[model samples]
Target: MRHKQVAYVLLRITIGVVFLFYGIGKFTMGRAVLVDGLVQQFAKTPLPPGLVRAFGNVIPFAEVILGFCVLFGVFTTMALALMGILLIALTFGMVLVPNPSIVANNLIYCVIVFLLLYLAEYNTFSLERLWKK
Candidate 1:
């Protein structure tokens, strides 16, 4: 494989593992705890409790599913797009809470996902590539 393809694969797998562990950690810690923590964290913010709760509930599942998709390069473009959307939502929530650090970190993730999407042509070592042949 070319250097660019190798680099892209490394980045994709690294981000995927990060997200996979993040989601798994949330589940292991209990989703209810995460929901409660989110509700408490956003209590003083302008965000609605119901929305926070719902997002908290869905985030873990989304992370795990998208993480696997990105890791395996299955529908890589779509997975990256969805990951971008998810990061946007997380960033919005952090912004509402005035958590600058997390917002900054999330923005970095957003940029990475954007790059992955934009350079998707280099994704030659993925399951999607194999399936096409």
Candidate 2:
């Protein structure tokens, strides 16, 4: 494979695996832990109690689905876009955390996701490509 193919595969797989593990970690760590983490954020925001709870519940499963989609390179563009949006939201929330490095890392991830979207046409090792051909 050429450099483009290798780059595409590497980015896709890395994004997928990172999210997949994060999603699974929610389950392994238990729901109360996740909810408590979200609770702290909720206290800082104007969001209603019910909506915050719902969001906390929805996030893990959503990450799993998004991860699967990216891993298979099916709807890669959409997956990258969604991931970008998520990173943006996470970056905003990182302000509540004490770790500055994680915020910086999230910013870097956001940039990488955007770059992949900008090069979406060159992602030749994708299920999208196979379907088109």
> Which of the numbered candidates is closest to the native, going by highest lDDT?
1
Residue 67, candidate 1: alpha-carbon lDDT: 93
Residue 28 in model 1: lDDT: 96
Q: Which 10 residues in a row give candidate 2 its minimum summed lDDT?
A: 90-99
TM-score of every model versus the real structure: 0.98, 0.85
The segments of candidate 1 whose C-alpha lies over 4 angstroms from its true place after superposition are none
For model 2, the superposed segments whose C-alpha errors exceed 4 Å read 41-49, 96-99
Give the local distance difference test score of model 1. Answer: 0.93
lDDT of 1 at 122: 91
For candidate 2, report its TM-score.
0.85
Provide the clash count, candidate 2: 0
Residue-level lDDT tens digits of model 2 in 40-108: 766866666676677778778877877888888988888888888877766765665445898999888
Local accuracy by lDDT, each model: 0.93, 0.79
